[model samples]
Target chain A: MENFHIDGSTYIPRIDFNAETGVLEIEGESYHEYTTEFFGPIFSWLEDYLEESGKEITMNFKMSYFNTSSSRRFLEILTLLEEYQNNKEGQVVVNWYYEENDVDMLESGEEYADDVELTFNLLPY
Target chain B: MGYMEHFSVKTFKQQLAMKKISLAFQGIFSQDVLALIGKSLRNTPESRVIAKRLFAIVIEMAQNIHHYSAEKQYSEKDGRDIGVGIVAIAEDDHHYIITSGNCIVKTEVPPLIERANYINGLSPEKLKEFYREQRKAPQREGKPGANLGFIDMVRKSGNPIEINIKEYDETRSFFILSVRVNKELQN
Candidate 1:
């Protein structure tokens, strides 16, 4: 299947998903005017990939900043990943990267981990 | 407090100097202006920890204005609709106070205050729990956000937010919100 890649905008994040490698990376800030519209295709692609490929997936969030609107969508993504990990034989691992000095970002990663079943490797850079 | 008709640059400068304000703006809130504000904050050689918190507060406050401010301005060049609001950042001995004020419909006041008060009443641990619940909640119609901006602001401030609402007209009122981030936490 095809991979997904979207360039970052002034108010949106960059997303790159590699189907072959089963690695999905989302980075930069996201505060788009149309939050759902921006994330809809990515969600669809991930679901399709998971159902069709049945391969192990690695989801990395290296976001510098994301607004509340984007954060809600992120929870949805996490929930889907949790489901993928539960039902499929393939494994799903999540990596959340935050700036070393940013406690809020670090805490945000921890918070997400608390809600999701999958463990998150909160790496500081 | 009653509405004041006297608002001038001189008075504004006085407030800035007296209050130790770092940044202040009163006009149309657009994406471009927000970018400039963010750039100005980044240009400062402050600790990254506090700077990130400050920047996040700015984004949430400014986005609130850009989307929900009652007063609107149409930009001819970009064909963008902008909001009118005021935002100010002040640094004191212990905390950085970020404040944003915008006009809101009178009917919106009750729910706004209710939410703010609810968030303010929550403890740190409870706040995190509340935020998780809110994050997973479905988005409200017409509001792209999950209505979690206020909660996020309260959570990041690490203190209760202060709010004031003054009736401006029969239909609109001025809503001001201030969040304080303790400098000691940066240490």
Candidate 2:
């Protein structure tokens, strides 16, 4: 598997998905014109990665902000992860990192945790 | 650039900032103006970055205007609602200022003001924590539609959030928010 790296733009976040470590990390802003267009491949990769047996996946998200369109897409990602965790043999962990003072971000993560079946660890960095 | 003009829809003058910028924009916050500024930010790297952050901020504010404003009409783009507003972007030596202005009713201002008051006072670390908690919590009224985007913008930009409110007319007034993104902090 190959790694994917996208430079973070002011309206977009930096995305790095490593096949070697099975760690997908995304950070920065994401409010693109076509929100779904940008995330299509990302969702696919996650789905494909889960096919590998005994593969440990660690998804880290340290974003400052995103838009409504992007927000819906984010929920889709979380949902996918939740299912992956349920069916996969290896352990999967979601590390949601936020600023210490930003209640909105922390709470956003918490909301996702409440909705999804997976257990997410909300961490402040 | 030297004087203020009044019209239903107008755009702001393009500016290049080196060090510092304030949190107020002096032009109409119409979609045309936002598009105009997006074009201007294309030339420089930092401004382009700042411009994107500014765009997200405006989207949220405009949505609030569309949803909460009493006097509003659907734009020509089918049913996309629009509200009267203004946005400004300025820069100097150290920081960048992104200001947005829109009219809101007296009743609507308090809750928004309270939220702004709560958000502006948090440190970067706390803001992140708050965001995480909010993300993991159940959907609150008027939250699922807007808060997600707002939180995303705050998390991606390496700056302090600022907000201010003032009255303009009966049952309607102006709400402006100025976000300052420091140059020295992030890349």
Best by TM-score: 1
lDDT (tens digit, per residue) of candidate 2 on B1-187: 4344563222332222222333333323344544445446545455444545555666665545544555566667534555556555666576656666777777877876677667767777787667656655554554324355445546555554566778788877777766665654353
Docking quality level of the chain pair in candidate 2: incorrect
Q: What lDDT tens digits, residue by residue, belong to model 2 across residues A1-125?
A: 76888898766689999989988899986655445568888877777777777778788889876666567667777777777777766667888998775555786688677777765899987
The residue-level lDDT of candidate 2 at B105 comes to 76
* Candidate 1: C-alpha lDDT: 0.84
List clashing residue pairs in candidate 1.
none
Give the Cα error of residue A82 in candidate 1, in Å.
1.6
Candidate 1: where is the Cα deviation over 4 Å? B1-14, B76-80
- For residues B46-159, write the lDDT of model 1, one tens digit per residue: 576667678788888988888899998996754778778999999888889999999999999999888888989988889888988878877788876567888888777787
* Alpha-carbon local distance difference test for all models: 0.84, 0.64
Evaluated on chain B only, candidate 2 has a TM-score of 0.67
